[model samples]
Target: MTTRRFFIKTTSLASAALFVKPGALHFKDAHIGLQLYTVRNAMGKDPAGTLAKVASIGYNSVEGATYTGTENFYGLDAKSFAALLKQNGLIMPSSHYRLGEDQENGKDLMGTILHDWDKAVDDAKTAGIKYMVCAWLSPAERGNADHYKLLAERLNKAGETCAKAGIQLCYHNHDFEFTQDNGQLPYDILLSHADKNLVKFELDLYWVNKAGHDPVALFNANPGRFPLWHVKDMDNTPQHAFTEVGNGVIDFKTIFKGADKAGLKYFFVEQDITPGDPFISITKSIDYIKKNLI
Candidate 1:
């Protein structure tokens, strides 16, 4: 992983612009999606109210991040949660579910981490979700290149299961995947080994940039593999911490220009750590997207 200090000092604005191909960009009917993790604190306290606020802020879609041990969305059952989203005029096309090593303790492969995934898929179908995403990997889950290969296999199986229920499985990445293990990037390994028809990627732009890589280059390399993206930004500071979308140094305009090649279907704004009120942060981000990126 690139150190924050090095990134802040070395990342060049001119180089980022040079990476974008000159072309006219247009996103027809594309709406902004919010990753609920941005307001995890608010959602934990009041999911309904938080969603209402999100809707009012012009977010037409959402991607859930609170569907782990509960099996339910936040505190509501799948049906009720879907209803809540409808009430606010918001639709959730995707949700983040943790994927880990299947503890072979008499349980099916993914059954250990994603309890009752079949049922979760069924519920997601009912909620009108099209994608079930593996949100993150723990330090233990990603040990080396071999571990990523094994994870790709697991993802293929999971994607097959979801496909039976008309859902796609995707892996959302962080900066860690870009780090090399034995001179091979875990991201490249997964992309190479995973069944392309079954599994896809949800690229997090900020983390990719933080890792000292180019998003447009990845899109050019594996066209149509990345259908989802986390549209977060990196502050132009020593910490390179999470900040409101357009407030940071990331050139989203340059990246969005290649959305077609990236296979971008849905993108969610996610600021992992807000400088102040999260709602305020997200509002600023969406405003910027509306005026600039979208």
Candidate 2:
């Protein structure tokens, strides 16, 4: 029901890459998600309109990116946001969260893992989310090998909280996580120290590849450790930038063949930056995904 006739009139209505051969695969819902940050600007302006457009573009699910500062999903409360999603025939299965830094004043910020963690989890439950990811570590936040060990502990604790809420907790990686410090990779340290039963990894395919590692080999190394993914593609340029799914160099078909091996439960199409109309780029990605990479 990805009809193109609702944005201008409905309240809830509002509103990538690559080349290569078109393959055959059915578009599957829930299995695929669009990380909302790809359209962060538009979302800031009109969450409902953007959601309608997202559904029209054929994405039935999304992973949230906003909640911390505003303590809402694009400025709407959890109940209101969830209703808007349902109105647009979309579901949000996961959301990213920040691990807030401590303040000299002794009061931590609201809407972060270290502060009002329970409230966030409660809101997530109301919004029908099943996974919560520790989004990123700021430059100052990630210092040395010991930093990762502490992070692992935090992730395990956070995972325990999420578990009680019936939600899985995951850590999203950036290329920085792979950089070796004193010959020990932070990513490796994290994977080793974090409680396996409690915390899982949300592998960012682009970043991992950017760090010069083989994802399949990583999957083989830690089977069933990855349940979520950010499926943004890397362009075939010298810069190796972001592009639409099939247009890039990533062999998604072969990568997807290892879905079961990686315990990949969900993945989202994400492009940090787009060259032209973001809508058109996403449409191109959706069309490609329809043909290949189910």
Reference-based TM-score of each model: 0.88, 0.88
In the range 1-294, model 1's lDDT, one tens digit per residue, is 975334322322111111222552334334578999989999999999999999888787899987766677888888999899989878899998877454335644442234577877888888889989998887868889998898998889889889999999999999999999889999999999999989999999999999999999999999989989999999999999999999989999889989889888888999988978999999899888765753
lDDT (CA) per prediction:
0.83, 0.82
lDDT of 2 at 245: 80
TM-score of model 1 (CA atoms): 0.88
Give a tens-digit lDDT track for model 2, residues 142-230: 98999889989988998899999999988999999999999999999999999988999999999998889988888899998988889
Off by over 4 Å in 2: 1-30, 102-107
Cα error, residue 17 of model 1, in Å, equals 28
lDDT score, candidate 1: 0.83
